[model samples]
Target: MPETPKKLTIATRASRLALWQAEHVRDRLQELYPLCEVGLLTMTTRGDQILDRSLSKVGGKGLFVKELETALLDGRADLAVHSLKDVPVDLHSPFALSVVLERDDPRDAFVSNGYGSMDELPAGAVVGTSSLRREAQIRQRHPGLVVQPLRGNLDTRLGKLDRGDYAAIILAAAGLRRLGLEARIRGYLPVEQSLPAAGQGALGIEVLEARADMHAWLAPLADPATTACALAERAVSRVLGGSCQVPLAAYAQVQGGTLAVDALVAEPDGSVIIRARAAGPVADAAALGERVAQDLLAKGARPILDRLSMPDASA
Candidate 1:
């Protein structure tokens, strides 16, 4: 067995949800290595800053982890805990995602003070969300509702809704459940209506690529099923060059010996949505994801992707 770490510091974002994720990891680590002194080192990332613009308009989800990666490179943190959906598909050199813990509810939550579900919202009512994927789906399904940009931490977004900035807002069900705010979720958007982002509801630990010992220490925390699913989902994103710039969603599930993946690409205005699904043996999860991505491209996702990548698409 590898020697247990005597002391470890985890890098984390300072938001309530981010701290909750880090502390959950810390508590689990303590249980495994009772003698280890685990501490959390919280820092704000650019993702947590610049609340005025959407993440897609800025730099994508990499903004969330760049500072934490710097911490690992400089020896300030042994590992960083991240919401897996915030991790980019291609990690830069010298850094690696070491483990994926078990997943929570991988569904989108509908929250509203006046509405019981999205279907109950009146036409022209405002709906706020921080994700383009969710926005596109809403527009496709409910063209009468006004979809608006909502940028901020969980609490901040909720506050906006409470103050009448929106008639309703969409949030990750996992975050609400994790924060013990499950009652706030009036309903859940079915996967058929809104496919989740890759690795949604899961936590990933990032470590330096050379940290063999750290990998050893963290190995026990990984859930084999979740890891396989996350791999497949991320594979789809990687093949499609997915980022916040595009309204893309990939979700995977592992059951018995089979692993199934569902993915989609959409125009920002929700006018176009291309979807694909594939299933295979769990051992071939990544390949199954790639197959689905190719299927989507064949189904006309290529033009949507090409148009979005153009320099003036946002203009």
Candidate 2:
């Protein structure tokens, strides 16, 4: 008798959005390799357990991805699914991003109780979000509104707004759509008004660098356009050293075979914002990001980067 084929285990966070991403990957893999079995292994990260402090104040985006990477390294899981934005800019040598799924909306969404859009929010209204990028953009546009730190899974955060703990909350539209919660979003923020973080709205498959077989299996799922755009956004963060405390923002989009990127650096209080944009062939996506970053630095991004690297006085 022939031996049984081994099942592929995909590790993911237990959040609804994370599960949706994993399921999407599973379906795609099944279609590609009909004989292979796909299984899901859910694990909680430190970030999920500790919700009292904002992500930047605690540990930044790494909080959401570190544990899953560890699982991959330890051979406990065959692959890990991650939100591309939550991934660190500089990955360790032991692991490689095996596949980048097709991207989603790549824009931020504003969900409020009764407001039609961000502009409709009353003056002094409170908006809840855990991202410095979102908060900074909000403050830049509507200084009169109050932005407060909020932390939780999607449902938990939405519940806070429903219970009147906050008048509105900002979230990634891709996440909401994946989990069938799109109805909660009052409006999607345009990239011109609110630039998204690097690699936002994309999902990544992480695997051991030495696992050539795994890469071969996953390679077919990758989307070159999405990969190009994500790399460009990540380049800016990698050049900046991935400081979680810094008020940094980056967005990359593909248009007419060209990739256009916008990056920003700002004081935490939204006081001194510096923005730069660049456009070039999609093949030069990474270079475009670097060019934008250099422009931002020339416009005074260096001092803000320096201050963010310093030890916190409050600590």
Which one is best on lDDT?
1
Q: In angstroms, how far off is 282's CA in candidate 2?
A: 1.2
Compared with the true structure, what per-residue lDDT tens digits does model 2 show for residues 1-315?
A: 123335788999999888989999999888977888999989999889889987777777777888888888888889999999888888888988888889999999989988889898889999998787777778988899999989999989999999998889999999999988898888999998778888889999999999888887888899999999998899998887656687788898888898988989877667778899999999998888888888888998888888786778114
Extract clashing residue pairs from model 2: none
Residue-level lDDT tens digits of model 1 in 1-315: 578889999999999999999999999999999999999999999999889988888888999999999999999999999999999899977999999999999999999999999999999999999999999999999999999999999999999999999999999999999999999999999999999999999999999989999999999999999999999999999999988889999999987899989999999889989889999999998899899999999999988888886766665
TM-score of each: 0.99, 0.96
lDDT of 2 at 128: 94
TM-score of 1: 0.99
Each model's RMSD to truth, in Å? Answer: 0.8, 2.4
Worst ten in a row by lDDT for model 1: 306-315
State each model's CA lDDT, in order: 0.94, 0.86
